[model samples]
Target: MKAIREARGISLRRLAKDIGRDPGFLSRVEDDKQGAGPGTLHLYASYLDVPLAAITHKEIPRDQERPGSPHGDDADPPPDGDQGSC
Candidate 1:
């Protein structure tokens, strides 16, 4: 999500302002530290000009993974250099 947003030249501040959310909260969501509800997901999809399925599909598969599994999608954090500063 963060990658797509950055690629589209959308800033965290601007996205939050447009979606009526706090930048910090949205940042957490982007970092996968928080889970976005359906409403929030819809807002993001609408603002980003993406289909809701694009976002929901990624989330659904992750949620179905067994807890404490040794292997799972995104079980590892991205490399430090890959993250852009907000």
Candidate 2:
């Protein structure tokens, strides 16, 4: 999520404001501490101009991360990095 957001050049503050969330809370999500809900995922997908599946498909934990895999599709999260349940 963070990678896509960064690739699109979306800033933490900007994305948070656009989605009606706090930047700090969003940050927690990125660090894998908080979880982003489906609603929030929709907001992020809409804001980022990407499909929800694109973000939700493969979020796995670092421990479960597959070798040579391109991305992490482990869990839902809040903001900060929204990996999408915070």
Give the candidate number with the greatest TM-score.
1
Candidate 2 global TM-score? 0.62
Tens-place lDDT digits, model 1, residues 1-86: 77567756889999999999899999998888998898888999899887777565544334334444345654667778899978
lDDT of every model, 2 decimals: 0.76, 0.72
Candidate 2: list runs displaced more than 4 Å.
58-86
Per-residue error (Å), model 1, residue 71: 21
Checking candidate 1 for backbone clashes, the offending pairs are none
lDDT of 2 at 46: 87
Give the alpha carbon lDDT tens digit for every residue of 33-63 in model 2.
7889988889987887777776664553343
Best by lDDT: 1
Quote the positional error of residue 56 for candidate 1 in Å.
3.8
Quickly count the clashes in candidate 2: 25
TM-score of each candidate structure, all chains considered together: 0.63, 0.62
lDDT of 1 at 63: 35
